[model samples]
Target: MVTSVLAGFAASAVLIVAIGAQNAFVLRQGLRREHVLAVVAICAVSDLVLILAGIGGLGAVVSARPGAVTAIRWIGAAFLVSYAIMAARRAARPSTLNPAERTPTTLGATLITCLALTYLNPHVYLDTVLLLGSIAQQHPHRWLFGIGAAAASLVWFAALGAGAHKLGPLLARPAAWRVLDGVIALVMLGVAVNLATG
Candidate 1:
């Protein structure tokens, strides 16, 4: 059981630690200190649901539906491309990148974007639902493995969102924000391209 849990945690941490749209957004929210807790909760909860579904064998069902996967891929790519464009615009205009000067987004809007970024990314389904689910089935204590995976998701998101404040001073400058936004735009575009082409 211990080995199973550890395996699950390791697998999940490997996947979640990667820099992606969800992580980037969470970090930004953390830096701004706006709706940080809510964003982290939503991300963690969503991952839990996905991991559960995967462990419950929904991964097989999803895999059987190529058309559904294709549809999600295209939709996710489109959404990501649009978001990348917005980020690029922000990067171009450093004036709007200042957290102090920029107006805080409403909680409702922030949550909605968070959900979209979480769900619309087909990679989330692939990694959490299909890959993790398939891996969990290998353990005698599959449920324990699932629990461990969920725990990892919670820990990762919480740390990312909470720890972002440590870099607040570094990002206080407009130049730093522009660099950050530029990186975000590139990451989003790269992901979008991968989704569309892969």
Candidate 2:
């Protein structure tokens, strides 16, 4: 039982620790200190729901629908591309990239963007729902595995969102923010292209 839980945690950590859209967004929000708790909560909760759904047999259902996945891919690619363009614009304008100088986004808008970034990424479904879910079934205690996976998600997001502020001193300058935004834009565009082409 303990082994199953550990297995789940390790599997989830491997998938969640990547430099993905979700992670990037979380890091950015954490650095800005905007809705950090809310963002982390939403991400962790969403992962829990999706992981459970997968373990509950939703993965099989989703896997059987190739068309749906394709639709999600295209939609996700479009959203990501749009986001990349916005990031690029921010990077180009170093003044606007500075968190201290920029206007704070509303809670509603932040939440909306968070949700869109989380849900619009087809990789989230593939990794959390399908991949993790399928792996959980291999364990003798599948539910335990789900719990472990959920725990990993919660821990990772919490750490990422909470720990990001430590870099506040480093990102204090507009040049640093511009570089960060540039990296973000590139990451977004890379993911978008992968989704569109893959």
Q: Best candidate, lDDT-wise?
A: 1
Clash pairs detected, candidate 2: none
In candidate 1, what are the lDDT values of residues 1-198, reduced to their tens digit?
998888889899999999999999999999889999999999999999999999999999999999999999999999999989988998898483576458899999999989989999999999999999999999999988988999999999999999999998998898898888899999999999999998
Model 2 is weakest, by summed lDDT over 10 consecutive residues, at 93-102
| TM per prediction | 0.97, 0.97
Local distance difference test values of all predictions, in order: 0.93, 0.92
* Candidate 1 accuracy as lDDT: 0.93
Candidate 1's C-alpha runs over 4 A off are: none
lDDT of 2 by residue, 59-154 (tens): 999899999999999999999999999989988874834674578888999899899999989999999999999999999999999999999999
Name model 2 segments beyond 4 Å from true.
Answer: none
